[model samples]
Target: MTNVLVCIKRVPETSGQILLSQDGQSIDARHVGYTLSAHDECAVEQAIQIARSTDGEATVLTVGNDDSLEQIRNALAVGCTAAVLVEADTENFGPADVAAAIADAVRSRETDATTYDLILVGNDAADTGDFQVGVRLAYALGRPVLTGIGTVEVQDGTVVARGKGPEGTEVFELSLPAVIAVQEGGVEPRYPSIPGRMKAKRTPVDMVTASVSPVGNGRAALRLPPSQPSVVEVLGEGPAAATAVVDLLYKLGVAT
Candidate 1:
């Protein structure tokens, strides 16, 4: 059976205005909600699909503190058969640090005879936009890796990945035991059902302590872009605006 491991990160939901912390080292998430990135959710869905089709197991993993349990349970509710948490304070953990922690966890699992045929991760982090984790993780494990993949499938002993290239869709094939960084839009992530949620609540998460030292991303501060200015011009009010509308459409070359 093909055992798949999907790596995810807990990121602040950006549905509202994002505030930075006083130290400017991270986002101010005290008042905001948290969720997985779109790419990570898609990767989890893909892993579940692959595992289900192969009669295998899909395990979800994350490097974060206890608060990340919610996100892990969400993945379990969808279809991941197992879950792992690398207990660590991710606030100051850069891409290299995160990658090292995950690699350690994977090696620990291997020691116990639990080997993953494929490891999936998001193409880039939603909060930091760090696109180096998957590549770094692959390097640490001595495995081939592909990034920006939208679709992936396993056949025989090969994994096929497809993504958008400069010209058109590009496809690559790698042997088993590889890493793939997934992008969104390849598959629709399924929502958790009531029963699934209940079942997930009972599933115990396996925890591992991160052994690597945190070398924070060399960022002095975080800055938000200036808001764009908006200007509105009222055209007309009621039926009296018919003439103005026709003229505007004609000037835009949409009228015959």
Candidate 2:
């Protein structure tokens, strides 16, 4: 059985206009809603799919504040066996701190006899596009790592991963106890059912304190480029525009 650990992040959903903080240091989430990162949702789904086939169990882990419990419960509602929360001030932590915290959590789990055969994480967090967690965790654990993975499965004790390459699909094979950074567009994440949600609500999350001090890479501020407005063109009018319409269609390859 392949026991898997999937890491997720609680991020502000970009369903509406994005608002930045006055200093451009972060997203202005005062009016926005929070949810699991899209890529991490796919990672959770893939972990469940793999574990279900082998009668194994999948655990979801997150490093955030108390509010992150909602995201952890959401993963449990889908199919994860349990959840772990590394309680911390998520806003104050940078990518390096997050990675250190996760690494510490993994080590703690190992001491408790909860060994994971595979580790899965989103290619990058949704809120901040810091893509270093998986790689850093792999290094901390002294395991092989792969990123931008679109598909993953186990066969004969080997983990096979696939993703889009410059020419076509690229594949990689690794032994058990490996790390993978899962990308979006890998699979459709299943929604939580009524019964599943009920069960998840009852599940107790294991909350732990960080064993390491959070360190930053000296980040200054974030800036976004101004958006370009759309332009509309009027192509003549009425019957007089018939010739223009035909020409437009021809130019668009709708007709020869």
Q: Pick the candidate with the highest lDDT.
A: 1
Model 1 per-residue lDDT tens digits across residues 1-256: 7899999999999998899888777788778889999999999999999999898999999999899999999999999999999998877788999999999999999899899999999999898898999999999999999999999999887999999999999999999999999999898999999999998999999999969987888888898788777776678999998999999999999998
Q: TM-score for every candidate vs. truth?
A: 0.91, 0.88
lDDT of 2 at 54: 82
Q: TM-score of model 2 relative to the true fold?
A: 0.88
- Worst lDDT run of 10 residues, candidate 1, spans 226-235
Model 2 alpha-carbon miss at residue 240, Å: 10
Best by TM-score: 1
lDDT agreement of model 1 with the native: 0.94
Lowest summed lDDT window (length 10), candidate 2? 210-219
* Candidate models: Cα lDDT each: 0.94, 0.90
For model 1, what is the error of residue 201's alpha carbon versus the real structure, in angstroms, after optimal superposition?
0.5
Candidate 1 global TM-score: 0.91
